[model samples]
Target: MSDFIKRARAAEQAMRSVFPATPLQRNVLLSERYDADIWLKREDLSPVRSYKIRGAFNAMRKQDGQDLFVCASAGNHAQGVAFMCKHMGVKGVIFMPVTTPQQKIQKTRMFGGDHVEIHLTGDYFDDCLGAAQDWSAEKGGYFLSPFDDMDVIEGQASIAVEIEAELGVPDHVILPVGGGGMSAGVTTWFGDRTHCLFSEPAGGACLRAALAAGHPTTLDHVDTFVDGAAVGRIGQKPFDLLRDRHLSDVLVLSEDRICATILELLNVEGIVLEPAGALAVEAVGEVQSFIRGKTVVCVTSGGNFDFERLPEVKERAQRYSGVKKYFILRLPQRPGALKEFLGILGPDDDIARFEYMKKSARNFGSVLIGIETSKPENFVRLFAHLDDAGFTYTDITNDETLAQFVI
Candidate 1:
C-alpha cells in the first residue's frame, strides 16, 4: 500500500470520532440526466455542512499540546475550525474579512461558542489572512491554513479513504479545487486508478492557471460568488503533488452556469447546493459524453448557502438560461407610453423590475426593465414585437459593467 493511502486510511479512522463519513449514495436525478450511474459524495451534508471539517478535525487531532489554533476564513473553513475548537476544548481565534456575510459570521460563532474568538479585519480574505498570521506569530499559537498545511491535506484525504471503502473505486471522480488540499489528497489516494476531473470557477481558476504556467500563479482577480472554492492560488504542496496532472484533467465552469445548476438541483431534485457545492455537479454536463456509461462520483463540497442571496442566484440562473433579461428602453414621454411598451410582452412574460431612469426628458424617458418568462423562446417573440412597434431598446442582460451598476 502507498504511504499516502495508508495515512489517509488512518486519518479516516481518526475522523469517525468527530463526525461520520458523509453520504456516498447514487443520485437518481443526475444518473438519469447523464445516462450514467452518478453518485454524490455529499460533503454538503457533513456536520459543518462541508468537507472542511474533516481537515480541521484531523489537523487538530494529530497535534500534541497545541492549545490554541488560529485561522482566517469567511466561509466553511471558519465554521469547520470553530466546530473543532469547541469539540476538542481548544482555544481558537478565527479571522474573517469584514465584508463577510453576517450569516456566516453568526454560524461560525455558534459553532465555536466561547472556544473561539472572531476578529473582523480588512475587506478581503487576503487581508484577513495576513492579520491572522501576524497575530499567530505574535501570540505563539498554531496558525491553521485552510488548505496549505500538510496535516490539513492528510485530513482531506480521509474523503478518498471513505469513498474507496464504500464503492471500491469509482470510474470517474469530479473534485472541486480551491487551494488544492482536497484535490491533492483525493488524487493521491485514487492515483491512476480513477480518472479525476478537477473543477474550478472560470473566474478564479488558479489551478488551471498554475497548470498553464507550469507553476502556481496568483490570479489578478477572482469572482467571489463561489466563495467556497474561488481561491486566488493553489497551495505549493498541492501543486507539487498535482504538477504532473494533464491540462485536460481540469475543467473551467462559468459562474452563471453554476447558478443554473444550483437552481436545477433545487427545483428538480429538492437538493439545495451552495455555489461551490454545485461546482462538481455543474461540470457533469460538459463531460457527459465521457462518463455516459461509467460509474461517476461528484463531490458536493459545501452547502453553506445564505438564503438572502436567493434572489441573486435566481436572477443569475434565469439570465443564463435566457428566460430572463434586463433592457434599457426609450419610451415616448406620454401618458400611455408604459402601456404601449407592456403590449410588446408575450402572454407568459412578466416584468420582474421596472424603473424610470430619465423621466425628465421631454421627448422620451429611459426605462430600465427586467422581464421574466416561462421559456427562453419567449424573448424571441418579445423582441420581435418590440421591433415591429419601432421601440428603441438595448438588451443589457450580458453587459457586465452596466449590470453591475444597475442590476
Candidate 2:
C-alpha cells in the first residue's frame, strides 16, 4: 500500500480510542429512487454529529506536549474540537462569530464542559479566526485549522478508510465541499480508483469557483444557509489537490433545493439533516443517469440543524418548487373588490397570508398576499385566472430584495 493509505489506515485505527466508525447504511428508498446501490456514510451520526471529530482527534493525538489547542469555527468543527478537548482532558479555546446560533454554542459548551473556553469574538467567522490566531501566536498555543492543515486532511482520510473496510470501493463517492478538507482527503485516498462527485451549495460554491479560476478565489457573495459548507474561499492546501480536477466533476446545488432535500429526508425517511449534510444526496438527482445500476455512497456530513430553522426551510422549499408564492396585488378601494380577489383562488389553493398596504390610496390599495397550492402547475392556472379577471398583481416570490423585507 502507498504511504498515504497506510497513514489513513493508522488514523482510522487510532480513532477507535475516541469513537467507533460512523455507520455505512444502504438506504433502500434512495437506492430505489436512483436505481443504484446507494449507501450513506452517516458522518452526521458521529459523536459530535459530524465527521469533523475524526480530524480533530487525529490531529490532537498526533501532537505531543500541547496543553492548549485553539480553533475558530461557527459550526460542527467547533463542536468537534471541543469534544476532543474533553475526551483528551486537554484545555482548548474555541472562537466563534457573535452571530452563531445559540444551539451550536450550547452544544460546543456541552461537549467540552470545563475543558473548553467558548469565546464569542467577532461579528463574522473571519474576524473570529483572526482573533484566535493572534491569541494562539501570543500564547504559544497550537492553532488547529478546521481544514487547511496536512494533519487534518490525513485525519479526514479516515472516513475513506472506514468506507473501504465496510463496503469496499464504491463506483461513485459523492462529497460535499466547504473548505474542502474532507473532500481532499477522500479524493486523495480513492484517487483514480472510484468516480467522485463534489457538491457545494450554489450560494457558497467556493470549490466550484476555485476550479473555474484554476486556483482558490474568494466569492463576492455567499449564502450562509448551509453554514457548515458556506466558505468564501477554498483552503489553499485543499485547493491545490483539487485545482487540476475536471470542471464537470463538481456540482453546485441551489440553497432552496437543499432545503427540499432536507425536508424530504426528514419527512420521508424520518432522518433529520442539516443543509450541508443534505448536499451530497441532493446531487444524486443531478447525476441520476450516470449512477444507474452502479454502487454509490454519499457522505451525509453533519446534522447540527437547529429546529428553529424548519419553518424557513419549509418555506424556501415550497417557493423553489413553485408550490407557494407571494405577490403584491392592487385592489380597488371597494367592498366587492376584496371578495372578487378571494374568489379567484382554485379549490386546492389556500390563502396563507394577506395584509393591507397603502390603504390610503384614493382608487387602489396595495395588498401583500401569500398563496400555497398543491402543485407547481397550479400557479400557471391561478395566474391565468387572475389575468382573465383583470386583476393586477406582481409576483414577488423570486424577488430577493423585496421578499426579504416583506415575506
Candidate 3:
C-alpha cells in the first residue's frame, strides 16, 4: 500500500473514537433510474452535517502541542473547526463574514460552546480570512486552512479509507469540488483504480478555470448560492494534486438546474441536500450513458441547508423546468383589457403573481405577471395565444439583472 493510503487508514481509525463512519447505502431509486448500481456516500450525515469535520478532526488531532486553533469560514469549515475545538478541549477562535446567515452562525456557536470564540469580521469571506491569518500570525496561533493544508488534505483522505473498507473500489466516484481538499484526498487514495469525476457549480467553476489555465486562476465573479462549494479559486495545493487529471473529468452544473435536483431529492427521496451536496447526484444525468451497468458512488457533501431558502429554491427549480415564468406585459388602459389578458392563459395555468400601474394620461398600463403551469409545454401554448392576440410582453424569467430588480 502507498504511504498516503496508510496514513489515511490511520486517520480513519482515529476518527472512530469520535463519530462512526457515515453510511454507504445503495440508492434503489437512483439505481433504477440510471440502470446502474448507484450508491451514496452520506457525508452529509457527518456530525457537522458535512465531510469538513473529517479534515478538522484529523488536523486538530495531529497538533500535539498546539492549543490555539484559528480559522475563517462563512459555512461548513467554521462549524467543523468549532466542533473539533470543543471535542479536543482546545481554544479556538473562528472568523466568519459579517453577512453570514444567522442559522449558520448559531450552529457554529452551538457546536463550539465555550471552547470556541467566533469573531464576525468584514463583509466577505476573503476579508475575514485575511483578518484570521493576521491574528494567527500575531498571536502565534496555528491557523487551520479549510483545504490548503497538507494535514487537512490527509485528514480528508480518511473518507476514502472508510469507503474502501465498506465496498472496496467502485467503478466511478463523483465528488463535489470547492477548495478541493476532499476531492484531492479521496482521488489520491482511490488513485488509478477508480474513475473519479469532479462536479462544480457553473457559477464558481474554479477547478475548470485551473484546468484551462494550467494553474489556479481566480474567477472574476462567483455566485454564492452554492455557499459550500462556491470558491473563487481552487486551492493551490489541491490544484497541484489535481493538475494532472483530464479537464473532461470535471463537470460544470447550472445553478438553476441544481435546484431541480435538490427538489427532486427532497420530495421523492426525502433527502435534504444543500446545493453543494446535490452536485454529485445531479451529475449523474450527464454521465448516465457511460455508467449504465457499473457501480457508481456519489458523495453527498453537505446537508446544511436553511429552511428559509426553500421558497427561492422552488422558484428557481420551476423556472429551470419551464413551468414558471415572469413577464412584463403592456395592457391597454381600457375596459375589459384586464379580462382580455386573463383569457390568454390556458386551463392548466395559474397566476402566481400580478402587479399593475395605470398612468393617469397614458393609453397603456404596465403589468408585471408571474405564471405557473402544470407542464413546461403549456408555456409555449400560452405564448402562442398571447402573440396571436397582439399583446406585447417581455419574458424576464431568465434575465438575471432585470429579474434581480423585479422578481
Candidate 4:
C-alpha cells in the first residue's frame, strides 16, 4: 500500500470509536437493471447521515490542544461538526447561511446540544464562511474547513478503507465530487488499482472546471438544488491531488436528472437519498457500457433529506421526464375557444393547473396551463392536436430561462 493509503487505514481505525463503518451493500435492483454487479457504499446511513462525520471526527481528534473549533455549512457538515463537538466534549461554533433549511439547523442544534453554538449569518455560504473564519481567527480557534484541509481529506479516505475491507477491490468506483475532499481521499487510496469515475452536478462542476484550467477555478454560478454537492469552487489541496486526473474520468449530472435517480432509489430499492447522495447512482446509467460485467461500487454520499422537499423533487423528476409540462396559450375572444382548446388534449392528459391572464381588449386572452400525463409521448400527441387546431401556445416546461419567471 502507498503511504497515503496506509495513513488512511490508520485514520479509519481511529474513527471506529466515533462511529461504526457505513454499510456497503449489493443493490440487487441496480445490479439486474444495469447487467452488472452493483454495490452502494451507504455513507448516507452514517451517524450524522453523511460521510462528513468521518472527516470532522478525524480532524478534531488530531488537534493538539485546540479547545474551540469552527466551521460553516448549510447542512451535513454542520451536523457532522456538531456531532463531533458533542462526542469530543469540546466547544464548537457553527455558522450557517440565514437561508438554510430549518430542518438542518434543528438537526445541528440537536447534535451539538450545549457543546456548540449556532450562528445564522449572511445570505450565502461564502458570507457565512467568511464570518466563521474571521471569528475563528479572532478567538484563536482552529477553523475546521468542510473540505479544504489535508487532514479532512485524509479522514475522508476512511470510506475507501472500509470499502476495501468490506468488498475487496471493486473493478470500478464512482464518487460524487463537491469541493473534492471525498473524491480526493478515495481516489488517492485506490491509486491505480481501481478505475475511478468522479461525478459532479452539472451546475457545480468545479472539478471539471479545475481539470480544464489545470487549477482550481470558481464557477460563475451554481444550482443549489443538490445542496450538498453544489460547491462553486474546488479546494486547492483536493484539486492538487486530482490535477493530473484524466478529464474523461469526470462526469457531470444535471440537477433534474439527479432527482430522477433519487426517486428511483427510493421507489425501486427502498433507499432514501438526498440529491447529492444520489450522484454516483445517477452516473450508473451514463457509464453502463463501461462496467458491463465488472463489479462497481457507487458511494451514496449522504441521506440528509428534508421531507418538506419531496414535492419539489417529484416535480423536478416529472419535468425532466417530460411527463409534466407548462404552456402559455393565446385564447381567442370567442366563448367556445376555451372548450375547443381543452378538447385537443389527449385522453390520458390532465390539467394540473390553469390560470387566466386577462387582457384589457376583448379580442384575446392569455392562459397559463400545466399538464401532466402518464407517458411522455402523450405530450407529443397533445401538441399535434393543438397544432392541427391552430391553437397558439408555447411550451415552457423545459425552458429554464422562461420557467424562472412563469413556472
> Which regions of candidate 2 fall more than 4 Å away from where they truly are?
none
**Worst lDDT window (10 residues) for model 2?**
121-130
Instruction: Report every candidate's CA lDDT.
Output: 0.89, 0.91, 0.91, 0.90
TM-score of each: 0.97, 0.98, 0.97, 0.97
lDDT of 4: 0.90
Sorted by lDDT (best first), the order is 3, 2, 4, 1
Model 4, range 1-407, lDDT digits (tens) per residue?
47787778889999887779999999988898899999999999999999999889889889977789999886889999999889888999999988777778899999999999999998666678889999999998899999999789999999999999989999999999988999999999998899999999998899999999998998988777788887888999999898989999899989889999889889877898999999999999889988989999999999988889998999999998889999998888897998998788878899998988776367888889999999999988998989888888888888899889877
Given candidate 3, what's the lDDT at residue 82? 94
Candidate 1: the clashing residue pairs are: none
Candidate 1 lDDT by residue in tens digits, 237-308: 899989999999899998999999998888888887889899999989889988998999899998888889
Write candidate 3's Cα lDDT for 1-407 as tens digits. 38888888898899999999999989999999999999999998999999999899999999998999999886789999999999989999999888776777899999999999999998666678889999999999999999998778888888888888889999999999998999999999998999999999998899999999999998988788887887888889988889999999999999999999999999998998999999999999899999999999999999888888999999999999999999999888889989998888899999999988455347887888999999999999999999999888999999999999989
Candidate 1 local accuracy as lDDT? 0.89
lDDT of 2 by residue, 1-407 (tens): 38878887899999898789999999999999989999999999999999899889889998788899999987789999999899889999989888777878999999999999988987666678889999999998899999988788889999999999989999999999998999999999999999989999998889989988988898988777888887888899898877778889999999999999999999999888999999999999999998999999999999998999999999999999999999999898878998887788889999999998886478898999999999999989999989999988999999999998999
Q: Candidate 3, residue 303: CA error in Å?
A: 0.5
